[model samples]
Target: MMISHGFKSSKKDFSFGPWKVTTAKNHIMKSKDIERLTEDLNLRALPEMLFGDNILRIQHNDGFGIEFNAIDALKRINNSDDTLQVACAQQWQESRVVSEHTQEVVRPYDWTFTTDYRGTLIGEEMQMKVTETTERINLEKLRAREQIVFFDEVLLFEDELHDHGVSMISVKIRVMPTSFFTLLRFFLRVDGVLIRINDTRLYHESVPTSLFTDPNEIAQHLAFKLRLCEKLELPEQKQGAVNEDLK
Candidate 1:
């Protein structure tokens, strides 16, 4: 169910024109979930806080929509042995040799958790022919103080990277009187090694005076389907992720 106005509930929801939006906020996954996910993902390790169940879902009346979730996001990380690693690659591997983590190092993977995922598309029509575009989201309109009607943020995953720095991904969304916006960000700081970021933005507006003017009609929608990656020289910095935490 989508709640466009009034008080926010345990879960966040809202609507825009023909679209219905919902989001879930959850704490780290339990050991059982972690074990299953690790085996399925074919990874040596996972983030300390992996909210594999949380997601940001937006759907249209016509069945076209998109979803952002941790499971799918993490799946995008390169598990191949040839994945490009960071500067402190050697240090990380050497450090692991001394720790119990060495047992899981069957192969090399992108420990950074870097992903090219934007969001998962739903419905047949929701997916149009893929094409390149230079269009960008309207930052000016998003900055408008239009009295946010709904807003929430949900974390996908986070890892302290052996206390080296931090790596995580979270999604935030807000709805205004005239439109709604969403941002999915992945941040990484490997300390003294590198700082990286990946972002995905989605925006849609209501235009009552548009060509097909309807009070509840959507005017324009700009989809950010590209993953932005930035790696910087970090001047710095888990285990089975101890069995604990449930929400």
Candidate 2:
């Protein structure tokens, strides 16, 4: 079965709108060793996969967006034995509200821009870039109001992955814009089954807006799928995945 993992943040039920946005720092561990992790995760070089090679482009609905290109920067890291550090950025529309006007005008009140870092032998880092752009009569005014906010950790990915016959991933995530809660997620892919786990902790939050999936439950489901796949004995195929949805 095919599965796509997307960004998830935990927040209070009452927290709403742009101000309620939360960032997360996750420890992403894949099922590859340090020497092979980059290749296995398709992050060996910068601009490797996901959303194509261009860093700046228009989205499906005519939304403008941009991301960092790390190809040249990563080449240096690959050539050197020393530790590497680099920053990547992305800006996109998080959500939008439709206007009552007859024309197709969308008033976007929430946008998310982030700067992220990935290293060969170190944990990942991320910073959310916030811009206060008002949707007024003059569109030019709204376009020029982009700015940077205080730097903070939003997402973290571990450089290494543990083995379990299949690729296993461990991730820790926290709410962004406003820190509300955190989540520890585990993922395992074997044959055609995908297993997911979410361990959550609430902080000053009344109700959880995210769903929690138990690791044990995932384990059982994974076990069943493995058996089923084995029984079916389908031929193995190799394929590549890109982050097209993000663009």
Candidate 3:
């Protein structure tokens, strides 16, 4: 899934008429720390449930919003080298090119974008080894694997509305399944990197003002949704994942 953040502001036009309006645009990059934080998050474990934790925390900027699958796992890699393969899945969006040579751009998938901060080394060959920098490593692609933290449901608070807040959104993912490859006891390799994930729904959406009367209404609506979100459960196969905590 992909998330984009933008700030809204009003524009005044007296000639046409007086109206309350807003516009949003992509925020530009200003800090090198964004890159570091993105890398840390890529290697960091995903919470059991989506929307859990400050998953989108930035060093200097306030997170405007995040768009993720309210439906299913965006992608899954099944191969001999589960360790290396899974790490790539978390870091990069997959693409296919006719040649590994220069001057050929693979057609990008519309359903997804590359969340991977690092470039892909799917077709390359490398020796695998453990390193202190990462709890688990995807040396086949020369990268690190992440551990899975507890899955949680994220709730957005809105105070300007009613007693019943609106449910902003709901998201979840299989965290333990992600961290399983990190166990040093198991080592594996991959001949190529494969990405097979697509969002069934739009990755990003705009909240409608008509959904609630005021900020309080939005808050109450979200409160109700959060409670319902808590009922969500990962499948039985996705339970009890364990990994070494990051130092």
Candidate 4:
């Protein structure tokens, strides 16, 4: 479960039960590639540490798969001028190079690069249908100290925002003898503004007995949800007051 890593492009592949998984890493895009990305994504600016070619993939023998990559995640960003905003986000961006973040009154896009991208689902047979289900991820099982057969972490993108704070999205996957778990997180910390975090978790057993009934048939038990957390960077004097209110 050794993963080869380097500053440039590197990829690792592993087979776990009926699933095939791979992680790819590459250098951030250069000026030429940046222009292409901006045009293709219709985004005025992107993260400084944008690993556009990095990717994580998991495929099942039954024609089902999921993938996480910088391109797909960035595409999910809001394109409109009137998207998620913050009080000082625009000003902070304007302080940087005018080419990167314009000084215009309103930016053309959400410079924050907030995204709702869960991993992409792919297959020729599975049709996505929305339905209600009571299933939830087993936190206890995930927390257990199981022997990890394979594990790897890859960064999709990251930005320092002129060193104002960190805004990054990274994906980590772990495969045990029993199941595989994947976590993708988008973390943002606008200095003196607020902290926002978004997470996507995927978990499935490598060998499910129920699927043995039909050798060629496979079903993915997925849990999808939008969970967000935000905390205002209030003054120290207000902290006690706010905490008292929760009482």
How high a TM-score does candidate 4 get? Answer: 0.74
CA displacement after TM-score superposition, residue 41 of candidate 3 (Å): 2.2
Please write out the lDDT profile of model 1 over residues 1-247, one tens digit for every residue. 1112222235767776787888877656898989788889887767767877788888888887888999999888888764546666655555544257455443347767777778888777565334678867778877766788788887788777666677788888887766778889999887886778989888877643453545334424434578799999956532355677798
User: Per-residue lDDT tens digits of candidate 3, residues 165-233?
Assistant: 111222232123222111101111222434332222111112345646778646632523333334667
Which wins on TM-score, candidate 3 or candidate 4? 4
Write the residue-wise lDDT of candidate 2 on 7-124 in tens digits: 3433222223222222332222323333354454333222111121212111111222222222322332322221211121011111121334444432211111111222122112
Model 4 residue 65 CA deviation (Å) reads 0.4
TM-score order, best first, reads 4, 1, 2, 3
lDDT of 4 at 20: 93
TM-score (C-alpha, index-matched) for candidate 1:
0.71
lDDT of 4 by residue, 13-106 (tens): 9997778998999887787998888888888788778888899999878867888999899988889864546666766556645454554543
RMSD of each: 23.1, 29.0, 26.1, 17.1
Total backbone clashes of model 2? 12
Which candidate comes out best when scored by TM-score?
Answer: 4
